[model samples]
Target: MVTPVRVVIALCLFVPFVAMLWVGSYAKTDPAFIGIPFFYWYQMAWVLISTALTMIAYQLWRRDQRGRSSRKGGVAE
Candidate 1:
């Protein structure tokens, strides 16, 4: 259970970072978005997504920690 959760959290944390890197490699002038280049908007969008993903990862980690603490309590008595 914890392993799967950890994998999911790791993916959530890493995917956006990889996307930002991929978008950064593209040319800015070829395709534009609302007068801004693809490079700029893509990175900006990923920044927002990254924040959300990070929040999700934090929540998952907290949940995992809580579960561990509860299990410990069960074993102690």
Candidate 2:
């Protein structure tokens, strides 16, 4: 049974991958941020965002595992 939490975690992982893959979307320089070009800053921002998303995914995964384990009487297998 797939849970909604798992779906949200999957989206968290998928969005960054898709965003980074679609390079042309942020390949411009007009929308500069803090003096950094769009191309450079966008990727850098995604780096931070990716780190956060990964942390969220890890925590969610751990919580899901714990839930499953408890449901099975805390058996480790």
Candidate 3:
């Protein structure tokens, strides 16, 4: 049941978790951005990035579901 599209969707969902959970990668106060410390700015940036990635994963999931439904002769996109 695994497809390339599903793999891509999994990647889209996994990246944000890996990025945020790996705190050492962003646990710094240097590289401040317009007064925002790296620690804070990095998290804020990931918030937006995570939102986008989640949206993409959701869309891909919908597409995958529709494909499966159609293959089963059910309602599809």
> Which one wins on TM-score?
3
Report the lDDT of model 3 for residue 71: 84
Q: Pick the candidate with the highest lDDT.
A: 3
**TM-score order of candidates, best first?**
3, 2, 1
- Candidate ranking under lDDT, highest first, comes to 3, 2, 1
TM-score, every prediction: 0.79, 0.90, 0.91
- What's every prediction's RMSD, in angstroms? 3.6, 1.3, 1.9
lDDT of 2 by residue, 7-77 (tens): 98999899999999998899899788889889999999999999999999989988888889998997535
**Model 2 lDDT vs. the true structure?**
0.91
Candidate 1 per-residue lDDT, tens place, 11-33, comes to 99989867866754764665787
lDDT of 3 by residue, 1-77 (tens): 78999899999989999999999999999999999999999999999999999999999999888879988998865
Q: Which ranges in model 3 have alpha carbons more than 4 Å from their true place?
A: 75-77
Give me the displacement of residue 24 in model 2, in angstroms.
1.7
